[model samples]
Target chain A: MISPREILETINMISNENLDIRTVTLGISLRDCVHPDIEIASRQVYEKITRIACDLVKTGEEIERDFGIPIINKRIAVTPISIIGESSRGDMAQIALAMDRAAAELGVNFIGGYGALVHKGYTEGDRRLILSIPEVLARTKHVCASVNIATTKAGINMDAVAQMGFIIKQTAELTAESSSIGCAKLVVFANAPEDNPFMAGAFHGIGEPECVINVGVSGPGVVHSALKKLSPEADFSQVAELIKKTAFKITRMGQLVANEASRRLGIPFGVVDLSLAPTPVIGDSVAHILEQMGLEKCGTHGTTAALALLNDAVKKGGIMASSHVGGLSGAFIPVSEDAGMIDAVRCGALSLDKLEAMTCVCSVGLDMIPVPGDTSEHTISAIIADEAAIGVTNNKTTAVRIIPVQGKKAGDPVEFGGLLGGGVVMPVSNYSSSIFAQRGGRIPAPIHSLRN
Target chain B: MRAVITVIGTDKIGIIAGVSTILAEAGVNILDITQTTMQELFTMIMLVDISKAVVSFEHLSGRLSAKGDEMGLKIKIQHEDIFKSMHEI
Candidate 1:
């Protein structure tokens, strides 16, 4: 029989490697709270969310204290307000206000689903929600917004995508005086998974149970450690096996923790996202994973292949261990969160070009990347457009969380601390994509699209 | 009777061609086949109809087993309906 300590050690081995439950998202469906009286509806929405999510922070804290594993963010995702309030003419901003207030009172860091799912066409509610994002994010401190404009089965919603380009530009312009911070909280997605525990793109699907606890487990450091053990003479096949085994062990631990947490909390267990989430720590970097795979550094030759292997292995191991595995359960190469990645940018070993190439196989795109302070709004829109294109073409979800550090140039660091790590602003190629971005038309869905 | 054959083992060359060849030789018509290669592990699922086959289910299983041995594959054959009922839940 296994001792308690042994079991604990096995489940918590990577805790010291900066491993944590990245987010514990409580998904609340608000479709039933709709009422003709907007005020009554808003009140009902607020009460429902508050009542259901009241235990979220407390439970997360308890789990953190008892298990000694940090639950970094306690978040809530409601049904897409647009669909929930389809009949309401001008209640989106009011509802968003109620959500913001509830999040503050409940002490959750972020609340998602302030946007729409307009992959095929836009409804009046969706358009209003899209228009209200600038105000919503500007006025609310904890709200995050996302729009799904494409899916493998439904093709791309070019009209919605085109409108988003304008909306994002407006959002950035309206909030530019405040550091254009609102754009950082918004994501545009394609093929978005329903059970992702991370933000700013988590929402309760209509099909989910009344409530569930989804855990996103991450440990770039653990994979890095395993790679450090490999001899220089090892071939690509050996390296692939090592990553597979390491991912298998890590995902097993996630399974155990998810089960234990669900049993303790009395909530139905959700998927365990086996993403190789990175941090600002030195050893806990996806770039280090590439370096370990015999690349001189990340952004070198064979980087994409190495990342593809690691990503595939992680999915395979996680799927075998849990039937409920979901989310972006692959390697994350967020720039500012990983020290090695930041260093690579500083040393010119990584560039936006290479980062874009890497995002094709990564779970997230252009994440936590810093651009020059003077980067134009059109340029920013262009960056998002490019990432969105990749996601649509590949039938994967991608997002950009870029921070335009004010008054910072290449090699200047902005420190957000904690999970949002410090990183230097990298130079954006001076060459302009503004003309293409300014055209402001939707790139039509691919011909093979079939998603509903 | 319809049957499903799941082939799982270390992947080598000609696993699909070998298995399909055996089924074809037995006068079995395959309805569907899906194979995925994950590193060294090769997994395949084949749905076939055996009611019109020239041989019995046991004989087909035996012949497939013999072919698997020749090809170093691990093969498991079951009635398609049985497999679906067991898994569809």
Candidate 2:
């Protein structure tokens, strides 16, 4: 029998500490759904997603009821639409609507992979998908779009970066009535994970199985609670130790839930994404964990070192608990979705520059940040370029999901509501980068990428 | 299959009797139980075997939870695997 203490601890963590499975994402490959005729291809995409992910939400709920774990989201990640729509010569938005319909019919919240990958350069399909993102995202509620413009081997596609800047501004303009919410559904990535269960960046990779189940587990509150028990004199190593032990327990729960979900759905279990994803709820912020590590605030001087330690220890502890660990398996520092981060930003303790520095050690870069309405397209591109450079140079995944909320400036708030929680717009540098962005070409792959 | 049921609230008479009654009616045999008091709050942990349970796990859980609500207690029934997997490995 499991010890009574352990049982009580698990219950307390769930009820009080917000320990829950963040997502049970079913990865469905849509490669076979390609057709030259746009309407037929769209139908095929819709049929396949609905057929494969029909039981996802129901099964997730059933597991939640039995295990008493709150599975927050049941989502679907399809093959990057660029590849699937390559041969089709029709409106890409039609296919995006198909995905939206499938998500609605299956009762899933988010259906990702309305994406284009132009790491080196764009093909006709990639160009079409990328160009259609602004309209596609504004029209579809559940569909998400990601564009991967850089990789270690391929370097950065400055052309795509330049294009995405315009697309993001257009997306914000199109969805301006709803707090410029379209930008929240779009992510630009360098080395985006194919098996990521979290969105708006998850996509079923080409190399993945035809159908599989991936789980992302998060518990910032659990980690925070664990650290509270540590003595003030606890060294950095002790802080690391406590974080590892807490993360191990969290990931073990993730592994169990992943295996159970896979078994129930009759899909191959892919991986457990060991990430400390936070919510807007109090006590569940990654920033609070940093503050608990002795920083007066999250974005202060020691913030990067604290985040680095937290990220490394989480990965180290989680790796051993699961059979497979993949995706963006570290702490996520999304500004809007975290209460502590929002406070940090609101109080001026956190800034875009410091956030960028912190992302070097964390999972993703510049996530869920809302900038001024008048922030230029060229500036957004320049920001994306910087993040891409970091990813390419360091050989780690980095992404930008910045929302340029129309009519909202710094000190004003944009209320996205739900899991896409509201946040105040943070000020961006007023410098112009139009000339730098207009220099269009690929930044050549690094020397380290030539190791083959 | 086994599950862990935890009952937490202010100390009250019939807390054990009420919880056990639901399990008995559902044909869930209680394997072990431990109760403790911390300050003014009471906590009871029960290990139960539901292999021969007449009701579904969800059904049994809902019934116990509804009973808890009536008695002003917080009751949670979770599969035992969650605790074992987290604590053991």
Candidate 3:
């Protein structure tokens, strides 16, 4: 018999601590759906996703009701729409419409993989996909897009990097009335993982199966609650130890949920992403977990060291509990989506530069960060380049989802509502990187590439 | 299949009787049950085998919860595999 204490702890974690399955993304491959005719290809794409993911949301709800744990988002990630339209170079926007329509018909929250992988260089299809991103994202409600512009082995595609900066700026302009919200759904990556279950970066990699189920676990509140019991004088090592124990338990629940979702949906179980993803809900912020570690604020001087410890310990603890742990398996600090982060921005304790530094130690880079509307596209490219350099040189996945809010300035409030939350815009550097961005070529693979 | 049924709220008359009646009607056999008071609130944890229940898991859960509401308690029935997986190696 299970102890009442254990049962109560699980209930407390869910009811008060906000432990949950962040997403159970269904990854479906669309390679076989390609056709020379654009309408036929779109129809095939829609039919395949609708047919396969028809029960995804229902199954997720059933699991949620049966297990008594919240499953937040049921989403789908298909092969990058570029590949599906490569044969005809058809309007990728039409395919985006099809994906969004399918997501609506199936009642999934978001459909990802309206993207391309152009780390080294672009195939014609990748080019078409990249060019269509701004319009596609603006035209579709439920589609999330990503462009991987760099890799450790192949080096950074500076051309793609420059192009995406302009694309992001265009996306913001196209949806400026809505606080440039479309930019929130776009991600630019360096070494982006293929099996990531979270958006706006998740995509079905070419290596994945026909379809699979991957679950992302979130419990910053749980970690915060566990740490709340410790004495104020607990040492850094003791803090790390407690986080590991708590993380082990959190990942266990994630794996259980993942397997159950897989069994019910009849999709092969992919990895359980051992990530402590945060929500805008109070008591659920990853920043609050850092603050629970004794920091007054999340992005202060000691914040980098504290985040490094948190990120490493979470992976160490989670790897043991899960059979195959992948995805961005560490703390996510998406501004505007986390209450503590939003508060930190309001109090002027967190800034853009500090966030860039924090991303070096964390799983993802510069996520959901808002900047002045007048910020230049060249500067955005420079920001993506710096993050790409960090990811490529360190052999880790990093991404930038920076939003340059149109017609807004530093310290001005921007409201996006819902899970996106809202926060004031942060200042960007005055300097321009136009010339540097215009000098487009590949950043060759680093010295570490000679490893074999 | 097995499940963990938890009843939590203020202690009141017939709380146990109410939960037991629902289980009895649904053919759910209680494997273990324990009750305690924490912070002046009553908490009861019951481990039950629902494989022989006449109702589907969802229907049984809804019926138990509706009954719990009438009895002024918050009841949740979760599949037991969640606990076993999280607690046991």
lDDT, each prediction = 0.74, 0.93, 0.91
Give me the displacement of residue A11 in model 2, in angstroms.
Answer: 0.8
lDDT of 2 by residue, A122-158 (tens): 9999999999999998899999999999999999999
Off by over 4 Å in 3: none
State the lDDT of candidate 1 residue by residue for A204-277, as single tens digits.
Answer: 76677777778787777777777787998988788878777767666655665566567766778888887888
Candidate 1 CAPRI classification by DockQ: incorrect
Q: What's the TM-score of chain B for every model shown? A: 0.85, 0.95, 0.93
C-alpha lDDT (0 to 100) for residue A397 of candidate 2? 95
**Native contacts retained, all candidates in order:** 0.00, 0.86, 0.76
Q: Relative to the unseen true structure, what is the C-alpha lDDT of residue A123 in candidate 2, on a scale of 0 to 100?
A: 91
RMSD of 1: 16.3
When 1 and 3 are scored with TM-score, the better candidate is 3
**lDDT tens digits by residue: candidate 3, A1-452:** 87888888899999989999899999999999998888889999999999999999999999899889999999999898888889964686888899999999999888999999999999999998888888887888999999999999999999998998899999999999899999999999999899999998999999999999999999999999999999989998899999999999999999998988899889999898989898889999999988888899988889999899999999998999999998888999899999999999999999999998998999999899889988899999999999999999999999999899999999999988888888889988898899998789999999997799
Can you tell me which runs of candidate 1 are displaced by over 4 Å? A3-12, A169-179, A405-412, A429-435, A438-442, A450-452, B1-89
Clashing pairs in 2: none
User: Which stretches of model 2 miss by more than 4 angstroms?
Assistant: none
Could you tally the backbone clashes for each prediction?
Answer: 6, 0, 0
